[model samples]
Target: MSGEEYRIGLIHATMNSVQPILDAFQVHAPQVTLVNFMDESLIYELNETGIVTRNMARRLLNLVEKAVMGGVEGVLLTCSSFTPVVAEISHLFEIPVLSADLSMLEKAIDMGNRIGVIATVEAAGPTTKTLLETISSNKQKDVIIQTVIIPKAFHALQNGNRSKHDELIHQKVQELNRDCDVILFAQFSMVRALETLDFTTVPILTSPEISVKSIIAEITKRRIVI
Candidate 1:
């Protein structure tokens, strides 16, 4: 609420996540300033290994430390595959440190009993599933999680075939329609696929915009406390 613009540090594992989040901030919280730190190799390693090892989580923690030292009001990790690292390290920081999917997954649990998670990355599906289950358990809600992983769609996106990537995700969303009460795009990169399904009855959620709002709220709360 002050004239000073809030600065948020965005840590990314891939370039695909960068723009969608920037677009989200532009549309939802234009007054905030954003700084980005990207390590493309993180995504490559995760894709190759199909897991976030301790070394990878350590690298992400280092990035967040750097961002905090740079004086950001909050830190947002834009990759879904590494969301757990936020829970592990956020308490170490004075400012808000967030996982891109935390708010979206929590919201999904509140909105429905049957939640659908669609991800293009192999690591993202299980990461999201675990997060969804944890959030539901913490909230004391019973829910069913359906995760669909399409690695080929990520390959198509990497090859610059955006249309094919979106098409693949859209087809899977159609199949999950009858079974799910809400669907979530697990990665910021998957937000583009939302454009393809205009008539779906199931509620579809994406992380970037909602996550931006969550971080801003956290920043505001901290500011008030100070």
Candidate 2:
């Protein structure tokens, strides 16, 4: 990248994950400009279907297309539930397309074979576990993944009770710490809960910071500057 500012587009499935990613960008890659496209309905729809429908895939593609047309150097899909779809069509775009959880998952796998995934949303737990398994398979590593979902935590977050949300997630993390080599927060929104708690048992991985760093690396690698 020359002297121009790099622009990155973020595709979010919910409003809950936006602020944490933005805050992470501000701290880690302050020079990069961020453009966010949020479709809160996508998460609800995916939760109901338990799979990515054709229409939902099309909507995600359209969002990426819009970001490319708007001159973004890279696109980050901040929804773990749609990672499979994003991975499928990522090659179609010339710009780098990254899943929010992949970077964190890689780190978790590298750290240990027994991984613990904690999610507030039911869909996120399975989706993230599958992604981790797939990635580990490709790397020729056999890993054991344990997933825990706290539906009420998500409900509390949606209702604006961040304290309750954090408390619930923190409790789960403490329980998983004894059994897991590393803990992965399955959703970007859940990463915020880490800020208020102190856990010394295992390394807790979150998506936003790791994903931001990955996107910045891609932008720098391609020398793409806005």
Candidate 3:
């Protein structure tokens, strides 16, 4: 917390949901602590169960407790899947707890015309899409949203083989560029792979950059004196 600014704890269910947000946040916050919850195994567990587990919920609380011990001012959960746990953790902590999806979904409602959400894991399909639709409906925005998946590329990242992951991302972007106006890199690990993706014409958005900005803006507007 050396920055003297408020610290926002980042809770990541997996590295796939951690890196990009942390990468973007480091530029904004020097005092942040990232709490990781899941391994690559959790992705498969999500696919198998069609819902998050009790252990997932427990780890989220553990991460927040650890963050508090480490002296975090607030917390941000990076996974769309484990937000149920995030909500519960928010009630325990005195400071703010944010879900990575909330702000961007707000933006999609406010400004996005045709939004493209791209996550690398196949299991992200139901949760991500459902969140988008729900947000759009709540905002009452005339938005068109399409969900995209790059499982092979994400799988490479999960295995810690970034070289292969970037390669797959390059090929995928070449095809996606034709369809999307803006691309949302939904996973945090995908941040490293951004420069590797070919987006000659379309602008790509990393969730960390946008989500962090939205959080900051809300803090400013509410003047939440952290």
Ranking by lDDT: 1, 2, 3
Every candidate's lDDT: 0.92, 0.88, 0.66
Those runs of model 3 whose alpha carbons end farther than 4 Å from true positions after fitting are 1-3, 16-18, 31-41, 215-226
Better of 2 and 3 by lDDT: 2
Query: What lDDT tens digits, residue by residue, belong to model 3 across residues 55-93?
Result: 866766777787667766556777766655665667776
Sorting all predicted structures by TM-score, with the top scorer first, yields 1, 2, 3
Kindly give the stretch of ten consecutive residues in candidate 3 with the minimal lDDT sum.
30-39
Off by over 4 Å in 1: 1-4
What tens-digit string does per-residue lDDT give for candidate 1 at 1-226? 2334799999999999999999999888888899898888999999999989999999998999899988999999999999988889999999999999998998999999999989999999999999899989999999999999999999999999999999999988998998999999999999998976666559999999899888998898899999
TM-score for each of the candidates: 0.96, 0.94, 0.79
All candidates: CA RMSD in angstroms? 1.4, 2.2, 3.4
Model 2 spans > 4 angstroms off: 1-4, 224-226
Best by TM-score, which number?
A: 1
Whole-model lDDT, candidate 3? 0.66
Q: In candidate 2, where is summed lDDT lowest over 10 consecutive residues? A: 1-10
Give the distance in Å from residue 131's predicted Cα in candidate 1 to where it truly belongs: 1.0
